[model samples]
Target: MSTFSLDTATVLAAGDASEHRVLIISLFVAFVLATLGITIWAGRQTKDATDFYAGGRSFTGFQNGLAISGDYMSAASFLGIAGAIALFGYDGFLYSIGFLVAWLIALLLVAEPLRNSGRFTMGDVLAFRMRQRPVRTAAGVSTIVVSIFYLLAQMAGAGALVALLLGISSEAGKIAIVILVGIVMILYVAIGGMKGTTWVQMIKAVLLIAGTLLITALVMFKFNWNISSLLGAAAENSGKGAAFLEPGLKYGVDSMTKIDFISLGLALVLGTAGLPHILIRFYTVPTARVARKSVNWAIGIIGGFYLMTIALGFGAAALLKQETIIESNAAGNTAAPLLAQEIGGGAGSAGGAILLAIISAVAFATILAVVAGLTLASSSSFAHDLYVNVIRKGNASEKEEVRAARWSTVGIGGAAIFLGVFARDLNVAFLVALAFAVAASANLPTILYSLFWKRFTTQGALWSIYGGLASSVLLVLFSPVVSGAPSAMFPGVDFQWFPLSNPGLISIPLGFLLGWVGTLVSKEQPNIDKYAELEVRSLTGTHAH
Candidate 1:
C-alpha cells in the first residue's frame, strides 16, 4: 500500500517498454540517493524523545504546511484519482473533494486545540483531562490499529509500484521491494526521526506539486488553453461520450451505491483530522497559531493540487485511448503515466521518456515520505503511550523512551512489510478507505468529546475508541471489501451480509452513541477542575505543557 499510483508490472512487461523501463529506473535511483542523503543528515540531529517524535517542535508554519501537504497527498490521490477521472469522468472528482474538505475540519477545529493540549501523540490530547493509564492505553491501541492499516496499504502499493518500475515479474522480487521500502522507512524514523521525515515530506511535496502543475499546464496546452475545447475533446474521446461527463457511470446512482458514496464521504471528511500521522504534524510546529497556519497553508496547497487533478484526469481521457489505459492497468492507475508518455512525445521519444520518468520518480518519493511519517507516529504511540505511561507508570527516562521508539520502529516496519507482501494483490484504495472509516469512527469522536464535552469521562473515551474500532473492523470483515463480489480480496468466500462496503455509515454513529451512553451511566463524577484547566488551555493556550 505504499502510496503507489499503479501496479504497473504488466504495463512495463507490455510491448516495447525497454526504453520506459530504463528511464524510470534511472530517475528512481537518483531520487532515492538524494533522500537517503537527507536521512543520514537528520539522523545526527535527532537526539531526544522530543526531537525524534516532534522534530524538536521547531518547524515554521509554511515548512510544516508543506510537510502536511506531502503526507496528505498519497498515490491514491495522484494516480488512482487521476486514473478514475480518466476512465469515469466526473465521478473521480468526488475523491478530490473529500480529501480537500477533510482539511477544513482539521484547520477550523482540530489543529489549534490539538497543538495546545498534546505533548507527543493524540493520546496526549485524549488523556489530557482523564485517568491517565486507561485513556492513554485506549488511544495508543486505536492509533496503532489505524496506523498499521494505513502502513500495510502504503507498503502493498509500494511493492506493486516497485515491481513495475524495476520490471520484476516474480513474487520474490515484489517481496524484496516491500522489504526495501520497509527498511528505508524504518531507517527514516529510527535514524532521521521526525525532522528527517519532515524534510523528506517537504521535498516530496514541492516536487509533486511542481510535477502536477507541469502536467496540468501541458494538458491545457494540448487543447490550445481553451477550457471548453478540452472538455469537449474529453467527452468525445471517452467511450461513454456524454454519459462520461455525467456522474454515476462508475459509482452508479442506485440506492445502495448512493448510500455507499455518502458513507465513503463521511469517512474521508472526518478521517484526516483523526489520522495519527497527520495529527502528529501539529507537534512538529512550535505553537497553536503555527499549527493553525500550517493547516491553512496545507488546505490552499492541497486544494490547488486537487484542482489540477481535474486537468490531469480529463487530459488523460481526452488524449489517451481507454483500451490503452485498461491494457496498461485495469485499475487505471497508470493513466497519468501513460498520459505523460503520450503528451511528452509518445513512448520512444526522449521527451516522453523524461516526463514519464519524472512522474514515476515523484510517485516513489511520495511513498517514502508518507511511510516515514506513518512509522514515526505508530512508533511514538507505542513508546510514549504504551511503554512509558502504561507499562512504566510514566517513570521512564527520555533516553529510554527514545530508545524504545527507535526499536519499535523496527518492529512496526517489519510487520508492515510482512503484511504488504501478503496483501500486495489487494486493492490499495479500498484498504485506505477502510483505514479512514476506522480513524473517523475510532479517533474523531473521542477527540471531539475529549476536547469539547466537559462531561466526557475516561470510561467514555475508552468506549468511544473500542466501540468505534470493533464496529468498523466487524463491519469491514462482513462487508464486500473482504468477501462478496469479484473485486473482494476473498471473492470465493461469500460471508458478506452487510449491504454497504464502507463502515462509516454505521460505525461512526455507534461510536458517538457509545461515548454518550458510557458517560451517562458512569457512577464517577466528572473532574471539573481538570476540565477547567483543559478548557482554558485548549481554547487560549494558557499554561499549556
Candidate 2:
C-alpha cells in the first residue's frame, strides 16, 4: 500500500449535528411503506401468473421505457460511474459511452424479438424452439449466477452510500443495507409482483434523473460554463491527470493491464443486451414495436444521465481536490458526494445538504428497485423454468406457479443478502463487469444462436451453456479479481497468469465457438419451423395474442 499521511481520524472528527440521520431514516421508511402499499394494491387485482410476473402485459410503451431505464441505471450507473468519472477523468466518460452504445445493440438485435417471444424469462425464448428441460435448466442457472453478481454490486454500492451518509462503519452499514434490501425486495415481488416493481422503477428513475441533472447544473454554475477550463484545471489537479484522460498503460503497469481495460470495456458494452434482469424487462412490454420504441426512450434517458455523470466526475476532480478526498479514504467512490457538498456549499449548508440527501435517497431507492427486479427475475426462472416445467411436469396451475414464484423470490433475496453481507468490500464496478461478462459468456450465445441459427440443436444449447459458464467462471477465478495475480491484492503475490482483469475477451468467443462446434458435432436437429414463424410474428407484432 502506498502510504499517504492523511489523517482519517481528523476528517472523521469534524462532525456536524446528525440532522440528516432523521431525514435518511424517514426516507427509508417511506420507501418501504410505499412499496408495501403498492404491493397490496397490486395483490387485489392479481389475476394469474402472467399478471404477477409480467404486469398483466398491459404496460404502455413509455411506462415500460421508464421502468427499463430505471432497471438499467442501477447504483452502478448513478453512483459507480459518477464516482469513476470524478476519480478517473475522461476514462469514466468512456464507460458512459460504452454503456450507452450497448443500447444500440439492444435496439437493433435483441429487443423486439425478445419482447415478442418470451413470457417471463429468456428461457421462454430459447425453449420456444428447443427442448424445454435442457434450455430451461441452462437459462435458470445462468440467471442465478448473473443475478448474484449483480446483487453483490448493488449491495456494495449501498454499503458505501450508507456509511458515507450515516457516519457508520462500512461493515455495519453493509449488513443493514443487505437486510433492508432483502426484506423490501421480497415484499415487493411477493405481493405486488411486476406491476409494483414497474411503478417503483418508474418513480425511482424520475427521482434519480432529476437529482443527477440538478447536481450537474449546480456544478456547471460553479464553473460558469467554462468547460475547457474545467477540464484543464481537473487534469492539473488530478493525481493521474493526462494519464487518466487517455487511459495510459493502466497505472504504468504493462501492456497486459491495457488489454485488461479494453477487455473490460468490451464486456460492459456487450453484456448489457444479454443481462437476464435487463432482457426480461423487454418482455413486459405489450409488443415488439413497443419494445423497439422503449429502447429509443431508454437510450435517450440513459444517455442524458451519463452525460451528467461526466460533469459530476469532472466537478469532483476539479473542485474536491485529491488530497482532501484521499485524506477521507473516500478515493474515487466518494468524489460525487464530496463534490456535491462543496458545490452545494458545505456539510450543513442547506442547498448542499438537501441535494446530498436527495442523491443518497435515490441511491438507496436505486438499489431497492434493482434488487426487486433481480429477485423477480430469478424467482420467475425457478418457478416458470424449473419448478413448473420439470418438478411439476408442466401440470401446475397458474396460481400454483405464482405461489412458487413468490416463495422463490424470498429464497433468492435471502441468498443475495447473505452473500452481500459477507462480500461487502468488493468493488461495485468490478462485480458489475463480472456479472456482464458471465451473462455475455453463458447466456447470450445460447439465446442468439437458438433464435437465429438453423443448425442450433438442443445438445448445442446444453453444451454452450455449460461450456460458456464454466469457462467464464474458471477464468474469473484465476483472474486478478480473486487471486491478486497481475494486480496483487497485496504487494508480494506476483502470481498473475493472465493479464486481463476481465475474462470476457476470451470467454465470450469461447462460448460462441463452443456452441457452433457442438452443433456441428450433434446429428440431431431441432424442428423449429413453427417456432421461427412465431418469433417473426412476435417481432413484427403480428402474433394473435
Best TM-score among the predictions, by candidate number: 1
- For candidate 2, the 10 contiguous residues with the lowest summed lDDT are 1-10
Residue pairs that clash (backbone atoms under 3 angstroms), model 2 = 86-313
Per-candidate TM-scores read 0.97, 0.91
Best lDDT among the predictions, by candidate number:
1
lDDT of 2 by residue, 482-539 (tens): 5563333332454556656688899988889888888889888667785567557655
lDDT of 2 at 250: 31
lDDT of each: 0.85, 0.74
Candidate 1 C-alpha lDDT tens digits along 283-314: 99888888889999999999999999999989
Q: Candidate 1's error at 529, in angstroms?
A: 0.8
Model 2 local distance difference test score:
0.74
